[model samples]
Structures are given as structure tokens and as C-alpha cells.
Target chain A: MSALRLIARDLRLAWTGGGLWLPILFFLAVAILYPFAVGPDAKLLRATGGAMLWIAALLAALLPIERLIRPDWESGFLDQLAVRGWADEAVAALKIAAHWLSFGPPLLLATLVGAALFDLDGDMAGTLLGGLAIATPALAALSVTIAALTARAGGGAAGLMLLPLAIPVLIFGAGSLGPNSVGAMPLLAAVSLGLTVLAPFAAGAAMRALRD
Target chain B: MEQRQAEPAPDAVVIDRLACLRGGRLVFERLDWRIARGTLGLLTGPNGAGKSTLLRIIAGLLRPAAGSIMVEGRVALADERRALDPLPTLRQGLRFWAAMDAQPATATDRVLESLGLAPLADVPVRMLSTGQTKRAVVARALQSGADIMLLDEPMNGLDKASAALMAAALAAQVRAGTTLVLASHIPIGIDPTTTLDMAI
Candidate 1:
């Protein structure tokens, strides 16, 4: 019951604070500009658009990381939560869920714009959306873990730290779109499940360390 | 006081030779104090005397370098930070915590009224002046309904009237069996059961 309220509060704040828009804009900008950068070769756009979208999604995930945990830490909201006897792991897990809710579906919806821009055939677009659906939980998990780690020392290096961790998701998500990749989707889901399960513990430990 | 520490009541906070180290220096050591239930305990010391550190330790937010503290009940804290959401109106910001604390719908208004924040309940938290923000912090701690409140400078930045209101509210809590250990450089307008001078 308390956990649901926490998530609702986070979502309400994210919506009201305009935290959802910047990353969506960044994602769309990448989609809109990719053809301009590489020149409008229709065949090339079809082949590489899925991979480009994956990269754009990964980068877009970073836009909201700085504010994810730092604001609560600075404002002493986390301390109050801690005083309520909330385990850090529980809080982190709920935050991951909230972050994904606020970021993932919107990013997928925005993919329609990207798909149109890239002139992606329906099959490729379907695969990209499916892949993001599976991969976004992992992306949300990774973003939150990094946010908790850097929340105390400062968030300046969160972006730099996030890219390396995002590689596995990118590999499996983008790889699943290849024509001959028979079993890649399951592998992507497996990785996402592991990350989604493990990230809360990692973030929880980081938050405990921050208390000292 | 030392004798009371020797034989602490079950519903009391007993610190036994507590020692704290912060930033590689020993803040305090071999400290002993006992705060019985319903007692108003005051912590007074000059700046850098580790008063805030001691409060955090009691609240279980910090680990002491040595020794132990046994607290009888759940704890809450109200420090310099208001901890309320800045974007929301004061009432909405507090309702979130009220929900978190499992308080009823009426609790937010009740605390706001007690703190004399009823008028500014519609104001965004970020726009509140320092004194109003201080009261809001207390309002939050009050709303938690914790048995023990470890407040750091709860009276700072308050005008005489607000300070008196705060003191009265805190006294009422104490009378109702909520233990309070507050650190303040100035008098909080309540007669404390015991005052621990950290500078010693």
C-alpha cells in the first residue's frame, strides 16, 4: 500500500515537473536527425534504423537520471522514508517501476514518429517496439542503480557511468532485430529480468553506504 | 542524570558510553545520557560540537564510532531541511507523507492548523519563507506520530509567536508520552526534563 503511494507520488511529480518531456524530445530529435546526418538513403535507413533507435533510447534514459535520486537525497525525503522503516531495496525497486512507467511507454509511443522518420517497414518497427518493451525494464534498472551510486558524491559522472552498463541491453535489444537472429529475443528478456531483479539490491546497498 | 543512566527505565533512551567520529576526528566520546518516556530532552552546544551528529545517531541515521544506544520506540526527525515536495502546495505535499504514514485524510489539515500553517496550506513549499518552512518540517514530524522525535534546531528562524506555537505543540506531544530530544542554540520555550550540554 505504501509502495503504491510512493510510485504514485513519483509519477505525479515527474509529470508535473516536466521530467518526462526532455528525454522524449531528445529521443525524437535523434530519430528526426539521423537521416539528415547519414543522408536520406531509404535502404540504409531501413537497415540501420532499429540500431539507431536503440542507441537513442539508451541516451534518452540518461536525461532523467541526474534528478532521479539526488533531489530526494538533498531534500531529506529519503531520510524520512528511511525513518519510516522502509528498506532501501523496497524503495529502489518502486522507484525503478516508477521511472520505467514515466519513461518507457512514452518512449515507445514516440517511436511511431521515429519509425515514420526512418521509413521502417512494419515488421522492423514491431520488432523494435517489442525489443524496447523487454529492454526498458533493464534500462530503468540500470539508470536507477547509477543514479543511487552517484547521488551522494554528486551526479556529474552519472552519464559517463551509465553508457558502459547499457552495453548488454543494447547488444541483445538491437541484435534481436537482425533477420537471422533466431533466439535473441529470449536472451534479451533474460538479461532484462536479471537486471530488473538485481538493480534494487545494488541501489539499496549504495544508498546504505551513502548514509555513512 | 548519571545515576539515571545507571538504571534506565524500559521505556527510555539510554546511551552508554557513546562515541562518535566524523571526518576522521572524534566528535565526542564516553557520553552517557538517559531520556525517559514523555521526557523533553534538550541538546545544547556551540557550533561543530556534534549536536546534530548526536541527533542523527539517535534517529539511527548515523552509526556511532563506539558504544551503543537503546531506544524504546520508533523515531522521527525534523531538521533544517523541510523534506516536503517543493512543487506542491503545502497541504498536498504533507498529504503524501500522511498517506505514507498511514494517517487519515484529516491529519494533514490537523497538523497544518496546529503549526499555524492553515493559511499557507495552499502555498507552494518553495515559496514559503524560512520560518514557515521550519514549521512545515515540524508539521511533517508531527504528522508521522512517532514516539520519539529527534529535532535539529526546530526553533530556528521562527518569530516569537510561531516559536511559542512550536513550543506548545512540542510540549503537548511530550505530555502525551512522545519523547523529544531536540538540539537548539536558543531556548525552545519549554521546560526540559533534562538538558545535555554537548560542549562538555
Candidate 2:
């Protein structure tokens, strides 16, 4: 029940704080700007649009990282939760779930615009969406974990640290968008599963360490 | 304020041979204390004397360099930091914790009234003044329903009247069978059953 309340609270905060919209706006901006940069060549746009969308999603995921866990840590929310007999892992897990719920679906939905802008064929768009479905959880996990780790240090350190760690998810997710790389979808899901499983514990340990 | 019949407090918190280290320096060593049921403990110390550190250790937020702490019931801490969300109204922020603590939302009403925050209840927490924010933190600790509360500098930002109200509410909590360990440099106007004074 408490976990549900926390998840609800997180979602509410994300929505009210405009955190959820930032990523979508960023994704759309990237899609919109790409054509201006590369010119209106349909062949070029169709060929690279899916990968650009994937890149946009990855960058958009980074938008929420700095605020994700630091404010809670500074405000002593984490300590209060710990005292309430909520394990750190449980708290981290709930935050990750909330983060995913806030960004993952919206990002998927925004893919329609991405498809239109990028001139992606239906097949490529389907593959891109499928890849994101398998991969966004991993992205959320990575962001949440890095957010916890750099929570006390502050600044853009978390974002810088996150990029390298997220490379595998990006590689697999973007790779799965290729015509011949349909087999990468399962591998992407596998990586996401590993990250989703490991993130809570890693983030929880970092939170505990911050108390010192 | 009416004094209700005192209930027998069932909780006890004991810290033995506790040592704390901060920034590679030992803040304190071999500190021993016990807060038994129905008693108030004042942890008094000068600056840099580890008053807050000891409270954090007791609250299990920080690991003691070497020691054992046995707390028989739920423990809560209200320190210099306000734990409530800044985005929410005072009432909503307090309600979040009350919900987390599995208490009814009405639990916050009594706390709000006690701390004279009833009028400001609808104000966003970020808009609250310093003293009001401090009172809100106290209100949160009071409503926590924890058997043992470790409060660090509980009266830091309060004016005299608000501080007195906080003292009365804390005294009420003790009367209602909650064990309290308050760390404050100023006199809170309530006599503690035991006082642990630390020096640098």
C-alpha cells in the first residue's frame, strides 16, 4: 500500500512538475530539427530516422536525471522513508517503476510523430517501437541508478556517468530497429531485464552510502 | 493544555559503546545511553560535539563507527532538514507521511493545530517561513506514531511561543507513552528525565 502511494506520489510529482513532458518535447524537437539540419531528402530521412528517434529518446531520458533523486535526498525524504521501515531497495524499485511509467509510454506514443517527421516506413516504425518497449525499462533503470549514485555529488556528473552505462541499451535498442537485425529484440529485452533486476539494489546501496 | 492520564510506555532505546567518525576524525567515542519508556532524554552538546551525528546514528541513518543500538519499537527522526515535499501544501505534504506511516489523514490535523500551522495548512511548503518550516518538521515527527523519536535541534528556528507549543506537544507525547530523545542547544522549557551532555 505504501509502495503504491509512493508510486502515485512520484507520478503526480512528475506530471505536475512537467518532468514527463520535457522528454516528449525534447524528442519532438530532435525529430523536428533533424530535417532542417539534413535537408528534405526523403531517402536520407527514411534511412536514418529510426536511429535518430532512438538517440532522441536516449537524450530525453537524460533530461530528468539531475532532479530524479537528488531533491528527495536533500529534502530528507529518503531518510524518512527508511525510518518508516521501507527498505532502500523497495524505495528505489518503486521510483524506477514510477520513472518508467512516466516516460516510457509517452515516449512510445510520441514515436508516431517521430515516424511522421523521420519518414519511417510502417515496418521500421513498428520495429522501433518494439525495441523501445523492450529497452526503455533498462534506460529508466540506468537513469534511476545513476541518479542515486550521484545524488549527493550534484551537477551534471550523473548525466555524464549515465551516457557510458546506457551505451549498451542504446546499441541494442537502436540496432533492433534495423531490417536485418530483428533478432536483436530478444537480446535487447534480455539486457533490459538484467538492468531492471540490478538497478534497485545498486541504487539502494548508493543511497545507504550517502548517509555517511 | 489538559494533562491526560499517563500510559505506561513500552519502548526503550539503548546505545552502548557508540563511537562516531566524520571526515576521518572520531567525533565521539564510548558513548553510552539508554532511553527507556515514559522518559524524555535531552542530548545536549556544543557545536561540533556530535549532537546531530549521535541522533543520526540512533535513527539508523548513519552507521556508528563501533557500537550496538537496540530499539524496541519504531523509531522516527526529525532533524534540521524538513522531509516534507516542497511542492505540496503543508496539509498535503504532512498527509503523505501520515499515509506512509499508515495513519489516517486526520492525524495531521491535530499536529497542524498543535504547531499553530492550521492557518498555513493550505500554503505550499516552499512558501512557509523558516520558523513555520521548522514547526512543520516537528508536526511531522509528532504525527509519525513512532514509539521512539530522535529529534535533532527540534527548536532551532522557532520563536518563543511556537517553541513552547512544541514543548507542550512533546510533553504530551511522553504522557501518551512515546519515548523521546531531543537534541537541542537551547532550553526547550520541559524538564528531561535524563540529560546527556557532550563536549568537543
Provide chain B TM-scores across all predictions. Answer: 0.93, 0.93
True contacts kept of 1: 0.79
Residue A129 in candidate 1, Cα distance off native in Å: 0.8
lDDT of 2 by residue, A1-212 (tens): 88899999989988888888999999999999999999999999999889999889887877888777998898888998887778999999999999999999999999988998887888889989988888888888888999999887785687788889888888888888776785688888888899999999999998888778
- lDDT (C-alpha) at residue B2 in model 2: 31
Name the candidate that leads on lDDT: 1
DockQ scores for all predicted structures: 0.76, 0.77
Single out the weakest 10-residue window by summed lDDT for candidate 1 chain B. Answer: B3-12
Candidate 2's residue-wise lDDT over B1-200, tens digit each?
A: 13322534443878899998898999999998978787899999899899999888878788888988887778888988898777889999999888888889889999999888999999999999989998898888899899888888888888988888888999999999889999988998899988999977
Model 1 TM-score on a 0 to 1 scale: 0.96
Q: Mind sharing the TM-score for model 2?
A: 0.96
lDDT of 1 by residue, A80-146 (tens): 8887888999999999999999999999998888988888889889999999999998999999999
- TM-scores, each model vs. reference: 0.96, 0.96
Error of 2 at B114 (Å): 1.7
- The 10-residue segment with the lowest total lDDT in model 2 chain B: B1-10
List of clashing residue pairs for candidate 2: none
